[model samples]
Target: MVFKKLLSAFGVGGPTVDTVLVNPNTRPGLALDGRVNLVGGDAPAAIEQIVVGLVTRVEMESGDGEYAGVMEFHRLPVSGAFELAPKQQLSIPFQLPVPWETPITDVYGQRLHGMTMGLRTEVAVARAVDKSDLDQVNVHPLPVQERILDAFARLGFRFKGADLERGHIRGVHQTLPFYQEIEFFAAPQYAQVINEVELTFVTSPQGIEVVLECDKRGGFLSAGHDVFGRYTVAHTDADRVDWVQVVDGWLQQTTSHYGGLRAQGFGAPQGFGAPPGYGAPHGYPTQHGHGGHGHGHGHGHGGHGRGVGMGGIVAGAALGAVGGMVAGEMIEDAVEGDFAEDWGFGGDEE
Candidate 1:
């Protein structure tokens, strides 16, 4: 009947799609294995295409302020146009290669707070509303990253929070459109000189560039300002040096340089043309027991929330409890709602 055609056009008789990942856990430069299971509905239909994309939340800077939304960084097409008979079932296997620069979502077997990742499936049919499915994904840190994080834990710095910032650092080689900042509160000894520290890692096939931003407290004579530091480490450097000492030295150098800058009349704070220390502050030792200079710091913008937590792991108890809730709602919208409309991916065919 004519009424039946109207109902089918509105998805009442369209195909349903479900994506199942064999293993949701993955790492950078790896492949995600999964299958798209489809069940045809009340009437035969023509499926325009089936696409699987890796989507995650990214914070972007706008005219007035910043806003966060889901973005599909990489996409893979599994199937093209196909005819589906009513009630027919089809299974399509796929292996999606995750990029080497994928932001990490889990650390030390625990989910990092303020991070979310998912796999989304988009199925477009001839005359029905498109349907999608989302699956949470876990991306673990690389070996070098793990060592540095564990070192932070060993150094008494507590994890605060993490977030993705849109923009590229001046001196770092960044492959992705954005970068991640993992923040931590200052330990007792450094508390008087600094408030918190934000750590960022820009990775590449050759090595990883580690950036540090230390927020210093104001002194009796000088105003407070953030100092930056950057360090480069090879993937093979894991287990080769004492990261605790290296990190400590970097922090010390970053904080120590303020006195010299202040004396040089580098008086203004951020946004007022304050001196951004591009290398180890002038006179601070840049080397550890091993030789080679660590990267220095400079001024930048934007960050996320902060909190207290146990050794190097981001505010564990509360973060572990609330992570699922945050990811659930955000990712649900990404897969179910208007993807193109929400993320400004205009003209990207479903």
Candidate 2:
């Protein structure tokens, strides 16, 4: 997902830059390395600075309603005060730690439906700077994360869709202005209790804070409510983990947890992850659209927008009686504009 192009913003005859990341996918608390290659377009110019920033689109709550904005959470200064001569080619190598709370972009080498990430390059000339390239980054889950997901699948919970969310949960330590949400269809055993489920991860050095939102469907005998459950996990245990049993435990524990808000002893230590300290990031309030069966307004744009059938979990519900639902929030996949045709996500029933 790396993007390379001539530094067009600086005009013609400027240096062209291309960024190639070593490997796009890895678990949490790992390093993402790559090289930034620079080639003189016409002649070498004085290069003053090279900067890289991690950016993502997030939802924001406002007086009117929920909106989307890009949040640049982490930045690194690679090099400074360098010169490029005509026909000169230089590559700057970078090895940086992705924020412990960085969102997971893929699962088992597959796209997580609607998640998007980019590495933006900024080149400085003298005192001025030019935004150069945007490299689409693909990040996968940690081993433990994968195991939990596999358990859900094996238990018959189909993958729905995943996307970064804006804002913070009510009682969480947040540093960034957004979080990541992964939605899932209910497993057959729990179909009668919930229509769909939305998952969010807020990570820190200790581990990841897992937030689960169960969207209950209104029926003749019952109304609906959004049931939330939060938990944590350690990093080192990912390798030697019993993820299937652990995740199943979470589902079982949470499903039986009704009536009032529930918070359990799930947080664990995984050592320090980079710098800054332990705190979650972002702030996007869950928005709800009217008559919409499930979550919030952010759901549409949060993913690839509505037409894409972006969220697989909600779509899976449509395949069954307890299925077929309109996701209410997250702003990740649903769209209100002229929705485009869905591709890559759906075709025949799986």
Candidate 3:
């Protein structure tokens, strides 16, 4: 909560800062409320501005592999042209806007463990000195996000891990340098389809982009390849989508179409080159990419995370179900496991 300023710039008896966030935990589209307390030095000074930034930890991709770093995702100016008299106290309250694509750091009231969000406050002063402060912030799931998460729990995919990765999904139009990947183990019905699944949600003013990747089983005489699918659901769909049915459909459609071919469904698959109809993913609503010939997509997590607990499969008659299904597990492996080694853990800096 303490702001760090260049004391040397202000000479001796320099002022100090501490930023207190009234509401650290918030949703993707919610606002962050906080106040910056500034204690002036022995001399009076003209304050230039107060800046707030949202910082996140993300993985970067490199030819040698991946790396990690704390990157500032967004910034806003809270105030400007102010004055702080000698030995005077000033408080600057601010409500910063959260980006629509902001990553979700928690689910079911559980912190993703490895994930961390910080509010950085920067104070600009004339000659006396300037200082900045950083405080931790927590991001909760959106209503639609919660609906989808609960559906996953109901469907029996245990949580494994979650992290942001550098690089595009071949066809995603990303404004930021990286994207977040929420990994989950497969349920019983979808077992034969593959080992696990990774979900990514990209949002904008218009709607959200849901990406699903499935690691399907190879045929009796063939090696199985991974298949991916994407869905464009609007915020209004939060209560409307039978996520269970929608997700199930996605899994089935993805596996059946991209089975072993080079096609990726709906969105771009890692290495399948690019989809014919889909443009970049960042500009999602514009392209609505998912499904098509997706070669060996860029997902390198494999099936090395954690073990799943026993859970019942989907309701009604069992379809072409196979393999032992996994229950909904908390994000144990994700928060504890080293993502940098497995995927793009922290590739944002470079």
Candidate 4:
């Protein structure tokens, strides 16, 4: 998608900018190739700089409650100062390197419920209002990550929703200030004890750190609480292991006796080994106790009542079963509305 806007700061005869993405679909550790096209209006103008960044909506906790806002996490400068003559046209090509820990916005061709991502372009003038544009961005999952997701579907776990939380996961390395949580309703076999499961993936060149937060059901005498589990898997293991069995084991270990595992500070159970050069055992505290300043309840964008069955998901049915079309339209609207307001570029600048 492409977005074009006039330089409002420059007044009537100001320059205009149009950002065009070569392709919107990409994965983590990849690059989004695009060009910024500029056209002079009726008069010449001095261009200060041109930049592009990745933006998304994140749920943050406040004193009263939680609110969602747009945030730019990664940016790259495309061009420096330059001069444009009357009616002159120029194009600046750029390659924006996606971060290794970038969140996934799409799975199999279906947009994930409650997830939205975009690439924003900003062109600053010497003393004029900066012109900006935004285009939707789609990020797919890595092979290993996809395998794990498929495993969940095979296990009868239903897709509930997903959202970005403005906080870090304890005992995990993160380049950004927030993390993505893919939530799922519990499968029938484990519904007796588990209500839902939240999954997080922190990726690197070597491998990925998988974090699981399980919401346990209350027992006759015990109160309900959240259990945390962490595991390490290599990219090469994407095709080597039976992901169904592995994920099932992880769920069993996590929901059964997470207290003992937390005390031991261990990695995955025996037989599931971490790749060479992997870090030490990852120990995660209870959900409410960690995350630096405590985690907030996420307000997902899509309706939470809709449920996506495992059979449908595994068969390539639209994963956005919870009104994906509506969610997609909402994403586009957010790109032009929420992003501009949050970035402080929609109104007058001081």
lDDT of all predictions: 0.66, 0.56, 0.58, 0.68
Q: How do these models rank on lDDT, best leading? A: 4, 1, 3, 2
Instruction: Encode model 1's per-residue lDDT on 1-350: one tens digit a residue.
Output: 56655777898877889899988877676678899999998888789999998877666676767767666677899999999989899999999987777788777446677777778888888887777877777777765676677667666787887777766887666667778888888889899989998988877765577878888999999998988777677665654455566777767766787433322222111222222222222323222123333222211111211111123355353442111112122242544545334333221211
Deviating ranges (above 4 Å) for candidate 4: 1-10, 259-265, 269-311, 314-350
True lDDT of residue 10, candidate 2: 40
Candidate 2 lDDT, tens digit per residue, 39-105?
A: 8645456788887766555545678776554456677888987877766989999976777677877
| TM-score, prediction 1 | 0.76
Q: Ten-residue segment with the worst summed lDDT in candidate 3?
A: 320-329
Q: Which stretches of candidate 3 lie over 4 Å from their true place?
A: 1-12, 81-83, 125-130, 259-350
Stronger candidate by TM-score (1 vs 3): 1
Please tell me which predicted candidate would have the highest TM-score against the true structure: 4
Q: Which ten residues in a row have the lowest lDDT in candidate 4?
A: 321-330
Superposed by TM-score, candidate 3 places the C-alpha of residue 154 at a distance from the truth, in angstroms, of 1.5
**On a 0 to 100 scale, what is the lDDT of residue 94 in model 1?**
100
lDDT of candidate 4? Answer: 0.68
